[model samples]
Target chain A: MYEFEFVKPTTVADAVAALGEEEAQALGGGQTLIPTLKQRLAMPATLVSLTGIAEMKGVKAEGGTVTIGGGTTHGTVAKEAASAYPALAALASNIGDPAVRNRGTIGGSLANNDPSACYPAAALASGATIVTSSREIAADDYFQGMFTTALEDGEIVTAVRFPVPEKAAYIKFEQPASRFALVGVFVAKYADGVRVAVTGASEEGVFRWSEAEAALSANFSAAALEGLSVPADGMIGDLHGSKEYRAHLVGVLTKRAVAAA
Target chain B: MTKISMKVNGKEVSGEVEGRTLLVSFLRDTLGMTGTHVGCDTSQCGACVVHVDGAAVKSCTMLAMEAEGAEVATIEGQANADGTLSVVQQAFQDHHGLQCGFCTPGMVMSATALLKDNPKPSEAEIRHYLEGNICRCTGYHNIVKAILAASGQLEGAIAAE
Candidate 1:
């Protein structure tokens, strides 16, 4: 890691001001950022630590929606959000490991937008709303691509609001090494319809499986997805698995998620 | 350099660290508390696991300044009063949970954290909770037994011969 000035701000306003400094970056749990810094992939003159901001740390559920502060750690979400949103909480509990869950924050996970991350699938499938320092962004518009979001420079995600689904479940085919999803699927059934999202399998990043959503909405069951399949094209292919394999897993995991839901 | 103060192993310690200084470096180099090893500098290995504010985290992945005013605990603190091995540590010894012993500290720390949350984790739960702490030698059978024993779930298992 290169030499940099670290500032911990107690408030989102102060954090934004600190981040507005020339070449300054917002530091979340550092689960991903610290590694990136160690690899010299990013160099910033200043790092604005966001963990100290108490206002951005908590989990609140009311009126069929669960709201979680951005700085709230995955460990907290796994425990706090379990009753309100079991599937999301289960997703939080399984991310990385116990230690990683202790430090990694939902805000950091959403902002960094790792293609293989679990939160993206949850947010997209649930159609959660992302509240930022400046404004609120719908999850549909929040995630732009892998490692990319609609966040502007100095913008910070303060909270995410998830509509509690009638029934939901996430199924992940984890890559042995990183524990990231080789192919993961989240199935959420709401009052109006069902939403299906796939992560860790796409080159374009977390995406809604609309066909599966439509099929499942019409009849929410694993049997409804028997004939549907995700195309191998645009899927991630690496030493872990082939693009075709990932596409196949996406279909399989989606069915599993539906069955589990 | 940032001047930070925190309680580690029940001791209030203060140090000057650079913004880039990892918490493990502060514990291992600044305080000379080397029990918290850094088997893999990357967060994957779990060798640098420690408790900051009473939760297990990868010290190597966290900056020293991030632990400001937080109560930190490491393997050095895992021992009981009067220097006896803690239950988890004693269980590891009785079960022969370690081989190379490189991953013992982390294993003990993670197991302690697990047992704190779950008093009697099933075999599958113990194995699942230990996903981050890798032991290349033990194949995790004894480690699982040690954790189960620590939770007092291993019926008729003796703590010492």
Candidate 2:
């Protein structure tokens, strides 16, 4: 890893001020950033550590919504959000492993915007509100693409607010080596309608499947998804699985998520 | 270089480390505590697992500066006060959980954390909990057995298997 100045700020304002420095980067849990640094994939003159900010580390449920502090670890979410959002908790519990969960933060995961990550699907499907240090961004507009987001320079994701759905479930077909989602689907049913988001399969990153959402909203069941299929085009294809396979898995996992929900 | 202080195995230690120095490097090189091995630097392998503030985390992935004023525990701290093996370590020995022994430290650390959280994890739970800690040898059967035995659920685990 390259040498850089590391500063741990106790407040988000301090962190933002630190991050405003030239070549400054925000460090969350470092579950992904640390590895990237080790590989010399990125280099910055200063690292603004966000984990030390006490106010940005917790899970709170109120007003029919669950608000998760950005710096909150996946393990914390798994335990604390279980009652408020079991589907999100279960998704958090399965990310990487126990050790990874302890270090990986929801803010970090959402900030990285890894296409294979689990949080994006949940955020998008739940229509979450991403509260940043500067302003709040709707999850729908927050995720831009794989390894991309709507975040500007020095902007930090401070929290994510998820509306507690009546019924929700996330089903992930993990890529064995990394445990990342090979093809994952999150199905969420609200009082008004249903939302289905697919991850890992698309090269365009996590996206809502409107067709599946329409069908499921009309009839919330596995049977409602009959004859519906995701297009293989634009899906990610690698040694792990072909694009077609991922597309098929998307459909299959969506059905499973709907059924499970 | 940054001067950082932390409690390692209950010993308050201070050192000068580069901004990029990982916690495992601090424990092993800076403090001469080599029990925490770095089997894989990319954080996939659990050989660098350690307890940072009572939670198991990959030391290799965490910068030493991040552990400032934190209580860090590694494989070197697993033994009892009298230097006897920890319950998890003893069970590993009894069950022959290791062959190459390369992943033992991480496996033990992860297992100990698992048992702390779930006192009596079933075979499936143990396996699921151990997803991060990979053991190329022993096929993880003996490792599972050792963790179950340490948790006093050996009989149930064996029957389930």
Best-matching candidate per lDDT: 2
* Candidate 2 chain B: worst-modelled 10 consecutive residues by lDDT: B152-161
Tens-digit per-residue lDDT, B14-67, candidate 1: 999999999999999999999998988889989888988879999999999999
iRMSD, all candidates: 0.5, 0.6
| Cα error of candidate 1 at position B113, Å | 0.9
Off by over 4 Å in 1: B156-161
The local distance difference test score of model 2 is 0.95
TM-scores of the candidates in the order shown: 0.98, 0.99
* Candidate topping DockQ: 2
Error (Å) of candidate 2 at residue B37 is 0.6
lDDT minimum window of 10 residues, candidate 2 chain A:
A252-261
lDDT of 2 by residue, A1-261 (tens): 888999999999999999989999999999999999988999999999998999999999999999999999999999999999999999999999999999999999999999999999999999999999999999999999999999999999999999999999999999988999998999999999999998898999999999999998999999999999988999999999999999999999998998888
Q: Which parts of model 2 have CA positions greater than 4 angstroms off?
A: B159-161
- Overlapping backbone residue pairs in candidate 1 total 0
Q: How many angstroms is the interface RMSD of candidate 2?
A: 0.6
lDDT score, candidate 2, position B22: 94
